[model samples]
Target: MRHSQADTILQDSMAKRRIKEVTDAVTHESPVKKHLENLLENKVELEQVLAQNSNIDQLVKAAGRVQPNPVETITTIDGIHPVVKKKSGIKKSQIVYDNDYIDVDYDTKNQPFRHVEQDDCKIPNFANTWNAIVDMRQSKKAPVDTMGAHCCADETQDRPTYEYQTLVACMLSSQTKDSVTAAAMDTLKQRGLTIENIAKMPEEELDSLINKVGFHKTKAKHIKQATDIVIEKYGGRVPNTVEELVKLPGVGPKMANLVTQLAFKRINGIAVDLHVHRVANRLGWVKTKSPEETRIKLEELIPKKLWAEVNHLLVGFGQTMCVAAGPGCSTCAANKWCPVGRAAVGK
Candidate 1:
């Protein structure tokens, strides 16, 4: 047989052996049986076999002593590893197939059509700007930084009424990180800090409840005050307008915009947090010193339709790609478009 044919045969034999080993592992009454079962189900080629043979499921159930959740396993073909779905509700599986691969050949003469570099380097018209940014963001040269994965506000579980939740999260997020805010939210939920509960709780008791978070005393006070305003003034529901939201104690523009966006799905305002400000300046998109200034500049430059996603994207991008000091511009996909990054490269 030809060398290529022999290699293919060898690979096929190895795949078969791997499948058998996986099957045998699943059949054994071992602790790893559940994991092996998931692995087999997630593997594209193996899924076909498992679907044809009901014995595989029986073997897995018998060995593991537990019925696995019938999750839709997504697989790719470019040598990507299989991903098992977890019950944690967080989707981490992006690679869909083992054979699905994206190859960018540097030496190839027939390059794929991509975003064109602006020769004049002048800001295009507002309509053209939106399209240009979108095209660049989608291209390899200026690919969007998706560091936070699905943990961002946009990706979180859709609450029926997120106004109260958004307020609580924003308050907790002050002088705190997202992970910390999530924990504090969980703690508050466990302690029943709903609109009704918060309205009823005494100020001192509320303080004690949220004492784990920084500035808990002040936050508790603000929470009580806000809850009272919501109950007495707003009929026990969080306000929809940014002006009304910011009228509450401890509610600034950043918090107000966050609450407005996440709770009411309103894109009328921009959340100009520190991350958004820093990243915008670094990219030379908005020449502003403060987040408040950056917000106005961005509103003028970027379209209103993209206002909602800007904060989430820029915050995630800031955390992952553009560090405040000593950013990794060389590996950044937005380097081509970033003035600061281009300057760094020139240096």
Candidate 2:
């Protein structure tokens, strides 16, 4: 009887399974020894079987206990086997906030993007760089505090009206630049912006005082609304926590965080603004789309101990060496490691 292709294919499959069964049964024996024994018993048959099925994938899969394929190791530029860790969403990349210090899990040998400078370029440590800049800038002159008007409330000669004035200043500073906000505060100081003054002050008169700032008219209304809430609800005391601070009119995370930072010396989160958002991303410390996202990213990477200092350091840097446009990157202290600064210098 002539055997068809199907019958021949079935015999070939049976032979492979029998080989797997035999190989699996002798688990205690060394693989090489068992193979040799099988070879000696049916040397001709085994040779034909080996030639027909050169690939061991089927046998390996059919075996009850299979030895897995080895994971190929990659060597880094330094010739070290880098410690690899898998973060859920992000691709393998390095975040060198400071040149002197680096925290990375994977080798940068195969990174998709190239740095402007060589890999071995000596970058200053993040902590040392910031501390030096802070000291240098602090010695030079302090940046105009956007909330200076609010803070002045605490320095009032009359302790009875201190909190009232400070809360008003905080509200006024929202959506206003420091210079404009400071000018607005000056007007308020000249004519008491106390809650009693604000609540009783005519809407037209209140808007006229802070008219120099952005959104003065709406702010005037919000000031009155916030003052009424403070007096009626919290007994005229500004709440220290973010939860309570946000309850005030037009006060979001930025205002809430700032108020507590200045008024109560409490910091629950980093207060991000246009400046903080720009400087953090330029420094290669955070990859965020918005100020709110930047605040969250900064909180994760920056140690809790440095939470109070971020707004100050970044804002100062933004105003000075890291200005929004025409920044003086050529003379920046972090120019060597700062991608933005280095590119500007190259330009």
- Backbone clashes for every candidate come to 14, 0
lDDT of each: 0.54, 0.57
- Show pairs that collide, candidate 2: none
Candidate 1, backbone clash total:
14
Q: After superposition, how far is residue 304 of candidate 1 from its true place, in Å?
A: 1.2
Q: Tens digit of lDDT per residue, candidate 2, span 90-116?
A: 111321111121222212112221122
Question: All predictions: root-mean-square deviation over Cα?
Answer: 21.4, 25.8
TM-score of each: 0.55, 0.60
Question: Relative to the unseen true structure, what is the C-alpha lDDT of residue 326 in candidate 1, on a scale of 0 to 100?
Answer: 58
Segments of candidate 2 deviating more than 4 angstroms = 1-124, 145-151, 157-160
Worst 10-residue stretch by lDDT in candidate 1?
Answer: 71-80
The superposed Cα distance between candidate 1 and the true structure at residue 341, in angstroms, equals 0.8
